[model samples]
Target: MHTAKILIAYDGSDNARRAVSYTAAMVGSGGNRLVDVAAIERPADRDLFADDAAWKAECARRIEAMRTSLNEARAMLVAAGVPEAAVTTRFVESCRSPLREAQECSIGTSIALEILRLAEEGGYDTVVVGRRGVSKQEEFLFGSVSTKIIHAAKGLAVWVVA
Candidate 1:
């Protein structure tokens, strides 16, 4: 049987690094697999400011930051023995307004939901994420996005790396 494709949710955390390491080990053993690293970018709140130019500039800066982080994660994955060709990266933007609208329209969509949707749509069989995100809040709560992905991703194994 072919190895399943793995989607690793990376946010430049130590746990994410562990996930990449684990994936590398699996792939090193001749596992037939494709690895995709995804980073979620939260959109800037337009309601917080009235200046359009400032919002645009902030958005651009955030995107660039996300890109840099993703690139670094990709490099780490490659260093861990995963072939560059076998790995892909994705950046998903999650805007609050769109989510609110979706909820109002009875869509009830979220970034976690979108991640699982993308995983399913792309035919990946497994999802990997860190125990915590970049925020590292110590409130003893699972990040909402990771928790949702864990519970809602039917037929797909979810791995939470510490």
Candidate 2:
């Protein structure tokens, strides 16, 4: 039997936590199923910090928080009857290549792009993200990740849990 690979984008938001619970219930404890919860840590703009040391400290702090959030998500899946072995967590530090920077400026934060890349590369059939809506002006200035993913996801199934 073919296993269903599910990829969940998590950011520790309340809606993100709900997405984790919903996915666990949807997938259940089936044998032929795998779930991956992924979180992205976008680097802080260097210009925002006073010095290089401060920037480095901020990055480290962000990474630590991401790890904590991933751990909590993992526990939630396990509690929901998903086997710990069948569930995995990924913490990705978003790439800062010049091309990627340009893409982020036009699209949403690089988090959405990174999640899409992970889903495609991991051969996941479904992508799940929590819906975090913003005002029209804010969306136009800085696009919402869920909206961008819905527009860009070609063949994969996407779930925008509110």
Candidate 3:
């Protein structure tokens, strides 16, 4: 098999940390071609009357948070001895629905699907998501993002790291 392009969905959770560690180990050994880290930004609260300026500020803040998380993940990857050039980072906004957006961004929901539409578009071969998310309820209820990705990613391989 060709070196797989690994896409790790990072959200700063312990599960996500494990996913990163696994990716580093798997790819660092020259077993994979490339590894990309993505942090999906959940949609902002939509209040029709919300102040535009405040909303913009909030958006910037969220992006900064995502950047911080990505940086942290990158640091971990480096500590794991993965070359910086071997790893890349991406950030996708969930827009109105993070789970739905992530699904839409990848392959459509289906069994015969040959490729996640979004992953193909983004040139990712595999998608890695955490079994749980950053939410407390996610520990109880199924993680919304991972659940959606598992069901909706169709043709692409999905790895759920816990």
In model 2, the worst 10-residue window by lDDT is 97-106
The worst-scoring run of ten residues by lDDT in candidate 3 lies at 106-115
Model 3 ranges with Cα > 4 A deviation:
48-50, 93-116, 133-143
Tens digits of lDDT, candidate 1, 1-162: 876799987666677778777777666535668899887666577777688777767767877777787887777777877778888898766554232222222122566777787788888989987666535564244356677777788988898765
Off by over 4 Å in 1: 13-18, 93-109, 133-143
TM-score of each: 0.76, 0.87, 0.70
Rank the models by lDDT, top first: 2, 1, 3
Candidate 2, residues 27-124, lDDT tens digits: the string is 77866789999887666777888987888777677767878989999998998889989999976655542223222221225678778988888899
- The local distance difference test score of each candidate is 0.72, 0.81, 0.66
Q: How do the candidates rank by TM-score, highest first?
A: 2, 1, 3
The per-residue C-alpha lDDT of model 2 at residue 146 equals 92
Across 1-162, the per-residue lDDT of candidate 3 in tens digits comes to 766677787767778888888777766645546777876564456484267677666766776787888988887887777777778887665445323434433222221132244467667778876665447776356436666667777556787776
Kindly state the number of residue pairs that clash in model 3.
5
